[model samples]
Target: MTRSPLVLLGKIWLALILVFLYAPILVMAAMSFNASPFYQLPFQFSTDWYAKMAGNQQIITAAIRSVLIACGTTVIATCLGTAASVALFRYEFRGKRILQVLLFPPIAIPWLITGTAMLVFFFAIGIGRGTPAVVIGHVALALPYVIVTVSARLSSFDVTLEEAARSMGANAWTVLSRVTLPWIAPGIVAGALFAFAVSFDQFVVSYFLSEPGDSTLPVLIYTAIRKGFTPEINAISTIIVTVSMAVMFLAARFSKFGGSR
Candidate 1:
């Protein structure tokens, strides 16, 4: 059977949208392999830029710091967010709606505003700028993502399982550990991955919270770009995009996001 014109048009529109979104990233990744530091075209391929990026101690340090911070944010956000999600799912209390509503501002507000606010708050509280400050800001930003993801997973869970467990003399801890957690494990993993991505890719909050000479990879890249553009910067950027895409891909696979399981 022949397809409808509208269906054909929709496919074409989708293809165009995908191309529009990813074409620049493709070009940047391609340029990272080009030998010319200035991005002069002729498509000459070389790994020199990658090698140089590896050799740069500052970049290496920043990359390591970014990973460590992302890991820390993932752990804290996933644990706290998972607990909050469970609470929101299992119990109703006074101001529960208000608590749920409060989770949005960290996500809905612009990062520039949030970052400046955090900087002021931390200063006022005497926390100041550094890795600790960066971690705090990152966890705050990542919590909403984790909570939302885990809460979505919790939505599909069977409440009868908890009731049955309780009737069988299973304690709350036992039911939570053995039943509820097992059912939502995928969501927890996906949430952790999302937390990692948010913290890893975050620039504005990291910039405000991180101390000078000690910044995350995204912040370091911004500093480098300010000095000048180089193939080395392109190389590092390509790496970041690759890692972030890989993480989201895993998150989608685990969570079955936007698709039926």
Candidate 2:
């Protein structure tokens, strides 16, 4: 059987796109294990970079901070975004469309602008720059993604199921806990993972909101890069990429974003 010219061309294009997207990450991961400090290529494998990263208190501290912030952001954004999504799905209000539109600007506007605005707002309210401000900033940045993700999952949900549960003597809370949540559980998980990734990888906003000597991993990595790149940086970066990719991969599987059942 002969493939159509257009189909063959599309496959070739997709292959090129995949290479373009992933080749740099592959190279970076390779270099992380390379013995060369300067990333000298003809690679000699070693775990030295990983060892170096472990002892670096600065990186370790920043990494812990990053995880904590991401966790906080995920919890706050998931709860709020999920509740908001449910409300949007179940209710009709005068400003329902406008309320939905409000979620977009945090996403539509560039983060730099949003970050700077947050800096100003926090300062005006005396929150100042620190982990608190960073968490707030991250949640704001992550909320829209969460809302959109859960909302998409909620769209295909059977409202009649909830109605049936109510008819069968389930209260609102019971209906939500048993009937509604189970069906949309995958979407919530996907949304939470997305929030974690956004907070974990956030640099620009974190940079602006974080206090001196206290910043997230991405901000620390940027500072390290400016000092001069090292194999340890490559190793840590590889870890970050691996973790984020793994999370999004799981999220894709759960959400069936690729249309897999």
- Residue lDDT tens for model 2, 1-261: 578999899999999999999999999999999998877878898999999999999989998889999999999999999999999998988999999999989988988898999999999999999999999999999999899999999999999999999999999999999998998888899999999989988999999999888988898889889998888889899999999999889878777686645
lDDT of 1 at 15: 100
**Alpha carbon lDDT of residue 204, candidate 1?**
99
**Candidate 2 vs. true structure, TM-score:** 0.95
After superposition, candidate 2 runs with Cα above 4 Å error:
none
Candidate 1 residue-wise lDDT, 1-261, digit = tens:
579999899999999999999999999999999999888878899999999999999999999999999999999999999999999999989999999999989999999999999999999999999999999999999999999999999999999999999999999899999999999999999999999999999999999999999999999889988998788889999999999999999999988689655
Score each candidate by Cα lDDT. 0.95, 0.92
